[model samples]
Target chain A: MRRERRRVERADDVGPYRLLRLERDGLDAGEPGQFFMLEAPGRLLPRPLSVCLATPAELAFLIDPVGPGTRPLAALAPGDAIHLLGPLGRGFRLDVERPLLVGGGIGIAPLPYLSARLGGPPALLGFRTAGHAEAAALLPGAEVVIDPVLVTDALPSGHDVLACGPEPMLRALTAIYPDAQLAWEAPMACGYGACYGCAVELDGRLQRLCIEGPVVAARRVTGASTMRAGR
Target chain B: MIPVLNASGCLDALTAPDVARTLDAYVTKTVTPLPREGNPPPRIAETDVGMLNSIGLANPGIDAFLGEHLPRLAGLGIPIWVSAGGFSAADYAHVCSLLDTRAEVDTIELNLSCPNVDAPEEDALAIVAAARAATVKPLYAKLSPALPNLPGTAAAVAAAGADGLTLVNTLRGLALDPATLRPRLAAGIGGLSGPALRPVALAAVYACARAVDLPIVGVGGVACGRDALELVAAGASAVAVGTALFADPGVPGRIRAELAVLRGRVPDPGV
Candidate 1:
């Protein structure tokens, strides 16, 4: 929960997304599906970015620059100071012997970390086009699906599913694989439990996504209308 | 010395107990009579200079908060200021009365200015009066910055037996998405807080400090020690850090330390 100023080692453009490698010292090896709140200078709120890669000296985040909050983060250059809070929120639970990773669009942010932890699991990734499919390379043995078809339709049967993506995609996947562990994203103010801004409806109650989960059991999610992705 | 506290709903004491322990008093999120799911998602938006949120007074309700969180919060060894909100005067009274019996509770903050709710300015005095009759504990009416006559409202609440005022809650604001041409927040509008609202809060504290003789808890947009000092110089007896907690959880302690440094450097008027 300490805020630290980390230097950006690199900000590389990968199709429609940007990958930022930050030089953070003494950071814990983040668990799969965990995220950090990145605050650029001059933005009122920080963007919640999942840890795409974590090492002792550096942390990587895959970002989609859709709104004012994230656009600046994507435009970072080397040696820029970016403020960060966390390695926060519960990550994906990897308990099954056979794990399948599924991600849609930038929702694939946490899969690479999960795959690395599982020693490279099979992944099914979805994107708007082949151009946006470059992220699939991060996941070993991943099959990419272009638009007009959802990645959920390609879910391999009989494997423990770990998924993250847009709300509609998550909803569709949860219906088919209710036992999956989902990394949910919502427009958050504080990427912690304080603001209760990133609340999701689960079991007929509202839960803060920042603490209760960025990763949660699909069955507990109940539905998708309560979820709103980054603006 | 008056202790610096966090305004209700701004900090989750349970999640960050270490940070909460640093504050002189811990203010819980506003609890209503019954459980609240709060507003829909897209409840928060970032404006150019501040943040907007329509959390809609979300809480586990009084019973759950008192039962589940109060014991743990009491263990933190900081004075607990339970913030109570409701739809009607009686609701405020009921919640306040229940908290009055708890030995762990040090003060009750009557949240009279939640923009997300249909809380009327006219009800401020009535709500305070009702809660005043129900509890012997000290009461602080958290005021709204949007009120037309803030001094008059502050005077009314004070006359109704409120011990002090938590000057200036968030001002209502809206942010529209440029791409979709839709409201950024699902709630359509939310209360604005952060550096943007600091001046408004200072103005309210200054006027109210002159209008009423009660202690004032300056809130809204306090980010640093300088901001807190400005509010105190404007006549606030204490200040609470809010939206800044998002950027840095250690802000409260940092501001406290900075304030001490600022105070030590001040030359005595006698000299």
Candidate 2:
């Protein structure tokens, strides 16, 4: 949970997103779904990003320039310096049989790392267009879907499901795979539990997503309103 | 010497004990009489200038905090200040009385103005007076910068027996969604905190410093050592880091070192 100034190694294009690779700088990449708070230059608040990939040398984030905060993050270049505090929050539980990875759009950020941890298990991804689906290349042999064909439409029974996506997709997946480990989203001021800004309705109570989970049992979440809490 | 503290409801000490350890004093989140679920989600919005939060004072209630959180916080080796919140004067007084006996509690910060909740009809002076009567512990009234007559309120609160003051809670703000053009926060309006708040905090601290002789703990958008110095220059005896701790947990130590560089001596908390 140390905040360090890390230099950007490179920024690679992955479909509509930017894969900003940062010098590892000895920072622990906690768990697959655990996130880092990246300080965007000139922005008042740092944006919370999930670990997209963590190699021995570098940690990478898939940035979706959805709003004001993320635009500068996606626009990073080689040699750029940024402050990052992480690997915060709870991530996917690794104990499972017949592991399956599920992601949608930018939610695919954690899959590459999670897959590596889970022995490169089967993955199903959904995106709005082929350009966006190009991120699936990060996962070597995952199944991809283009909406109006949702990733949920192709879920295979008997596999322990772990998923991340927009509210609609996560809710639908929760209905089918109640015990699935679903990664949730919320606008977070602090990646740690301090701010309580990342709270979302879970099990009929408002719980800080950054603390209780960025990852949780799907059945525990009742409403996913903070999904609109921005990127 | 400017002591550094954390704004109430901003840093949860138990979750980030290392971060809390850097502060001169660790202020707990506003403990209310009853447990709070807080407002619905979409509780935070980040604008170009700062961040807006409508967390609505959510907590496990004072009893739970005293039982579960206080002991651990006391063990952290930093001086503790409890931020007390409630709907009525009695609520404030009752909570204050409970902390009056806790040796771990070095101060009681009466949260008179949290923009996230419906403002109480009872004014800051009444709240201060009520809490003042209930507790032997030092009371520092945390006021809002948005108060129409801040200096006057500060004077009144001081006269009513407040030992000190925490100048400037977050100012009221609203952030609209760019595409939808609607309120971004579910609560519609929230308390704004960050660099954007430094000037407003300075003004409040400056004005309150002139109005009351008591020590003031300045808070709002204190991101760096320069900001803390500016607040001190504006008559604040201490500064509390709020939003910046979220972005950088190491901020307190950095600010302290920077302050030492600027002033040539480490500021004592004087707790």
Candidate 3:
């Protein structure tokens, strides 16, 4: 709800991604799966990052250096300052009795926080390689998978699924877990619904993903698909 | 004092009411006669200097606006400017007539130059005249800066009964993915806004202000107070924050504060 320039406490490499830790500075870490718009230095547009971990004093983001927007975020050194605005968008409804966290690649960014909110629920995380799988360290007790083997392949039954990852994985998960909670991503300009830049066709309607979701129920999405990755 | 408004489509007041309260008047996104799904995704792209978007005028249409959005916005206690878009002159006039009775609508801005849609070839004069005849509310024509005869169009629209002008909608541009070498936006091209648009917008405002006597709301890449001051110096009666609102919703208040500080340093030119 506020925009502040929080100083970077650390930017450590975890496989091919960066674990960016910033001083919390009065910003609320809202519900798990909610995202912040991180204004990457030197980039015209800010990139949306879900909170990877939130200690009382610091908020951490797991970033993959995918392209122009995220490379600078991954390159930030300690003592650098970055502007961020968020705790925006709908997050997971943590009312489930038997919660199961599912994530793929960088989508694991939101799972750690979500797990904490769900009182350390079981997790299944899938990455592309052994190096990429190193990020699994953040989710202490979660099972890990690499590409050629999807996390959906190992999905356990009868648990309320909370998921985030690439579009393909989400689509497959939604097909199986009709009541699952999924975090989706689209290229966004304004993380609040103003710009309509994040509009995705859901159930034959163009819904602004920023408002209806960074997290949404699986049944609400019919054919919506996104090429961009991350939560 | 000059008003600091948000350019149409830049700020959704319902979602960000606090940001809307910072503006002198809140301009709604372009609402058409019918609901539009907008362009396909990959709709936004970040350039080296600014941004490109092909949103295609997505909205809930006027019926939904009056029934749902306007009533909520009325509670915000700020003047509301409705941005009307259409495929034809009648479409513009029809929307204007529909809004004529709504007391909450303080102004109607005819979006005659949305680069994302296939706009009609009818001149601004025709669209402005149609809207002017349809509604008693003050009408402001939101024109594009990419026009070949911007000054002439401004003068004609003014003579046709436009009360004011919002100078410069985004100019058309394209960004491609370096990996694929294909269009970055699914729509193939998009309207460019942000810091790269400041000069083009200033030129439009400067030229139109000289050609017509109507008050102008200058908008484009206004990110800071200096940017707003420059627009005023170029003859704008008011300034609007556009793409910058995407990154910083607190922009209108910041620019206003900066403008207040800056106005003291510059000698009064009696603009």
Report every candidate's CA lDDT. Answer: 0.86, 0.90, 0.89
Local accuracy of candidate 1 as per-residue lDDT tens digits, A66-178: 87767888889998887898889999887778898899989889988888888888889999988889877777679989998888667779999999988888888888889
For B116-218, candidate 1 gives per-residue lDDT tens digits of 8887444798999999999999999999988889999999999999999998889999888877889888889899999889999999999999999899999
Q: Please estimate how well model 2 matches the true structure, expressed as its whole-model Cα lDDT.
A: 0.90
Q: Candidate 2, residues A84-172: lDDT per residue as tens digits? A: 99888899999998899999899899999999999999999999999999999999899999989998788889989999888889989
Q: At residue A92, what lDDT does model 1 achieve?
A: 86
Stretches of model 3 off by over 4 angstroms after superposition: A229-231
DockQ-based class of model 3: medium
Predicted model 3 interface RMSD: 1.6
- Rate residue B201 of model 1 by lDDT: 93
Q: Which ten residues in a row have the lowest lDDT in candidate 2 chain A?
A: A222-231
Clashing pairs in 3: none
lDDT of 1 at A11: 85
Candidate order by lDDT, decreasing, is 2, 3, 1
lDDT of 3 by residue, A83-109 (tens): 999998999999998999999988899
- For model 2 the local lDDT of residue B122 reads 91
- Pairs of residues at least 3 apart in sequence or in different chains that clash in candidate 1: none
Better-scoring candidate (lDDT), 1 or 3: 3
Per TM-score, the best of the predicted structures is 3
Best by lDDT: 2
What value does the lDDT take at residue A215 in candidate 1? Answer: 91
TM-score of 2: 0.97
Candidate 2 stretches with Cα past 4 Å from truth are B265-271
